[model samples]
Target: MPKRNTGRRHSVSADQIQKYLQEWFDLDNKAKYNKRFKRYLNYRDILTILFDRFPDLKTAYELKEKYIFFNRNTSLEEAEKGLAGLILEFGDSGIEEYHEFYNLLINWNKEIINSFTIINSRRINNSFIESRNNQIERLIYNAYGYTNSKRAKNRIMYCLNKKDSYTM
Candidate 1:
């Protein structure tokens, strides 16, 4: 008999991955079902929408920025306080999903937040990301013909700035 794995040692079954693949397949199919259809919102897309509406999450961002970009002389206590305040602010924002995520944050705070403290000078630029995204969209449209092949569509997309393979 195989010894039972316990606690956090659970092994993933092939079924789980297959299920996720099928789920995404369904989502993509739905997205292409009609010309007027909107693609299903994934997690990051949903968060982007939320941030657009409620942009007052600066405290949360500052804590993340402090750890991610400015690690010169940050103490652990300061990081802890900043995270605690961010959690409190989110919880009190009257957002239902935020409260649930806040609970998860409190539960697994230690592991995920551990030294979320890496300092790098260079920050990412949105313009570059947008351009790269356009490049990828063009590649996809060309390779799979996901979008309409009208002259106007091709002209607009062809105007994107060039990118090297390294950017991908």
Candidate 2:
């Protein structure tokens, strides 16, 4: 018989769980499903997880505010410093462990910020293109809302080839 591969499943850390909750909330707010109630359910899940993780109201509020502030205005380096400071203040670990946690926090922060920046930049460009496409669609609909397929194809071809005809 062949030996079984017995690798353990990787466990998610509390910090990662918190970050995932934030991302879930951001995505859920913009998504529409069968009904409007789906977003509320997602919101409730986020709240439940947060409350379970940090039962103390004060600590939870502080953590929420810190995350929001950093997410909105602070850079990745600043956020990493804030996280490291919090860990140093509250964690009951030795120096080596603390250092490890600090390094992890910094790396995670950098990764999140870099990913967010790239995604956000793409979203901005996509939004602009969507807006322009909407305008083009409206114009086409107004001019030939019920035209035959062949005529519509001709119109699109003319629109595309118009600019190329006048190249200097």
Candidate 3:
């Protein structure tokens, strides 16, 4: 198997476990059953054995998946309660790593909860504004030493109103 650029090197079994776990837990993996291929079958066998051998790892993995599920499925009204329940689970989990994550979540509780707010059926975010700012900065850099303010304004408006525009 080819190595992934995961920053840290892992043993073959560790890499296999990571790969299988991601494939299994991927939100976009809509297939009800995995492909009946030899490679996938081997990975499944390895994961089954690993899960049986290390129940704590299994529990941690399940808890990690719970957050992903919650984020995708919960409504804005349900988000606060759902996240609180997750935080409680993380606090009670025996895993030391989760306890650290629990503290981090607690520290950013308000901001994380606020991120669940939806407006006009879309999640509220600053991406459009940030992108516009970046575009303006690039234009300004490219148009350095320009004395024509009106022409610069027109250029900015023209560039920002293209077919693939993200403007409001």
By lDDT, who's the top model here?
3
Arranged by lDDT with the best first, the candidates are 3, 1, 2
Tens digit per residue, CA lDDT, model 3, 1-168: 975333344567978998998987665544343455334334446567678999988889899999999978888788889989999999888898888899988998877778788888887678899989988877777677458887777778878888644433
Screening candidate 2 with a backbone cut-off below 3 angstroms (N, C-alpha, C), the clashing residue pairs are none
Model 1 stretches with alpha carbons more than 4 Å out: 1-77, 117-168
TM-score for candidate 1, please give it: 0.28
**lDDT (C-alpha, whole model) for all candidates:** 0.56, 0.55, 0.78
- Across 75-146, the per-residue lDDT of candidate 2 in tens digits comes to 544656665565554343333434565566556754544533435445112566686576557557567574
User: Would you list the rank order by TM-score, best first?
Assistant: 3, 1, 2
Evaluate model 2: give its TM-score: 0.26
Winner of 2 and 3 under TM-score: 3
Cα RMSD of predicted structure 3: 11.4
